[model samples]
Target: MSIIGTIYEDVTTDVLGHIGSWQWLVTFISATLMVPSMLNQYEDMFLLEPPREIECDVSASSSVFNTSLCTYSVLNGTKVYKCTTWHVKFLWMIWFKKSWLIFCDHKIKLLSTTIICRLGLVFGCIIFGLIADSFGRKLAISIDVVAELGFRLILTFCDSESWFLLLIFLRSLFASANIYMGIILTCEIASSSWRTLLNAVVSIPRMLSAVCLVPLANVAPNSETFNFIACIFSASLLILLRWTPESPQWLLYNRGIPKAEKTILRAAKING
Candidate 1:
């Protein structure tokens, strides 16, 4: 009776922390290690003795990763900490509140969605590529970004699992298409000598964003927050497009000399 009573007391005290710790814990475990085989460094230390769980100090953490590492070291081995299931912080919770395992209660369904999204990309690339070639890069970009933004906004309000899946497919389609149109525009606008430099310059922001995403996610941890951010960015691009002209090369190739020449003159005047 004494042992059971003590165990129950401990369990009641520890339950809240475990439940709330998921957000930071998942983030830390997902971070890329400087050393891929981080466990190797502690091989000597862990060879004879496995570590026991120590109390995590939350006060010293600058980010979730720090908090997670402080909570438990990898040296403790899998037995001390194991993620049976995961949670997605932020707007992801609105739809996926129960489990990150996702709907249909099977891993295969999740895998199928990923496969479908990838296939959607293939069709998106081919279809949007031709659209950009047939119409203009500016128009294609505007169409694709607007569609993607709309889908993301719709996703926030979606409750039905089937509709959510469909929306994801649509978002993937538009996202892939937008990427193709963006690449086309970049290559079409830059001179041959400056093409490489233009590509590199444009890629820098994407790379920086990719690097900072996890940390930013820690701060803004909602799917809705990111969706809003994307919508604002897309809207800003639309506003900026008002001042920009259609690709002169696209006009020269697809339209006629007169229209292309007019666009160039307008652009030159704007620049001056």
Candidate 2:
């Protein structure tokens, strides 16, 4: 066939055929970075308003009622009256509890925020897929990391409910895009024999990251602290990216033989 095709075939057969340091390093970094991205995307679930004891005052009568649900309370036995003043006992200061007074009347709005965040995931996949194909996997991942970090930082300081919703959507959008891009890059660089195994291994970190959220939430004093810690963890990926190489397969198709050859040689040297 063509010169590029021959070189690509040789590289795939020779260099990638062996499981080596370069391949393992890339997979480890990519998988580890997925932790913060996932935490940022789904932290809202953990931050949802916890059940609270609510004491409501009845306007017409002197009777006060205590309930967990902030809806109407029975006064004597048959008379149901709407709650006027709310005495809410918060177990912890979370995003939902501190902001967006999501009582019984406004619980639907909280659900809407989660739905909007999920919608962002759908859009992120489509948009970033186009970006990865058009530009490059590395560029797409870099953009996703930076954008997710920026949105999350802003979200930490967000007080307004409207802004919080918007930031949640944007944050999840970019965070999720990195997941697929990382997977694609890893698979593209891996040997055929190792692809399935590497894919499964890489996914393990994602599950571990989800589990980590429990300790992270408990350790942080509040939602802002949780987000700040997540940001700090995410920032380390920037340094890791310095050692991360572009996919040689992508270079072969998009950037021609020379670029791909250089990457393959670098990987070989590192692997050696």
Candidate 3:
């Protein structure tokens, strides 16, 4: 099948955040961002006609009606009729109407968007591991989520489109810490016998996260609602961080002896 025409994505659930998980967080971050990423493209599926066409000239506006699908238009009519299932490309087109927003809002804040646009790719590096070493992967992931939550909250206030994109970039940064990288880190320290199996489970959440946003998208199904959902997911990810174990390997390598021992003890108590 042509990748371009694909309409829906498969959904699955397998979230795994380890005490020092890196991969899961990276995936989760990307998945979480994916919700808005695609949704941001939803505005263009339809088109419309002016009322004068309906009152005096159906033939004149014939081309406009036939030209688009899932659109909204008036042919000298009082109310607008939105077509069902507007094509998605139009969303990007509409944004350009205010293309100035791209530069005005945080969307193009130079370095930030460049750095953030690749949360999935970038987190594959050693940075997540370092975060795990200094802050405990769990805590580090938690912090990143919190920051993203705030990024979303503040994002709503931005009138500029450019700045909003910038905000999205920053949010992705935090997501990078909690998503795929976090998951990979967890699998690394999980029981070796079950590592691959559990790693597969970790990947599931990344998949599920997309579908989870579906109902959310349907509920309000608007840009504002979608952004709100993004923030909620970020916060939820942060809170769940407590359930994660501190990476024993991370502890052993960086803190040694007692701290590593305490980490194990802490895991027992939490699990118990």
lDDT of each: 0.45, 0.66, 0.44
Deviating ranges (above 4 Å) for candidate 1: 1-105
Q: Pairing residues by index, what is the TM-score of model 2?
A: 0.75
Candidate 1 structure quality by residue, lDDT tens digits, 1-272: 00112232232223222222321222122121111111111212221221222223333334323223113324334433322232334433432222222332365665666666666667777777777777766666667656755876776555465776787677667655444344344444444444455455445444554455444433444444455555555554545445444655666655456876675555444333
TM-score, each model?
0.58, 0.75, 0.53
Worst 10 residues of 3 by lDDT: 4-13
lDDT for 57 in candidate 3 is: 21
Q: How many clashes in each structure?
A: 4, 0, 53
Q: How many residue-pair clashes does candidate 1 contain?
A: 4
Q: Model 1: clashing residue pairs?
A: 90-221, 90-222, 91-222, 91-223
Better of 2 and 3 by lDDT: 2
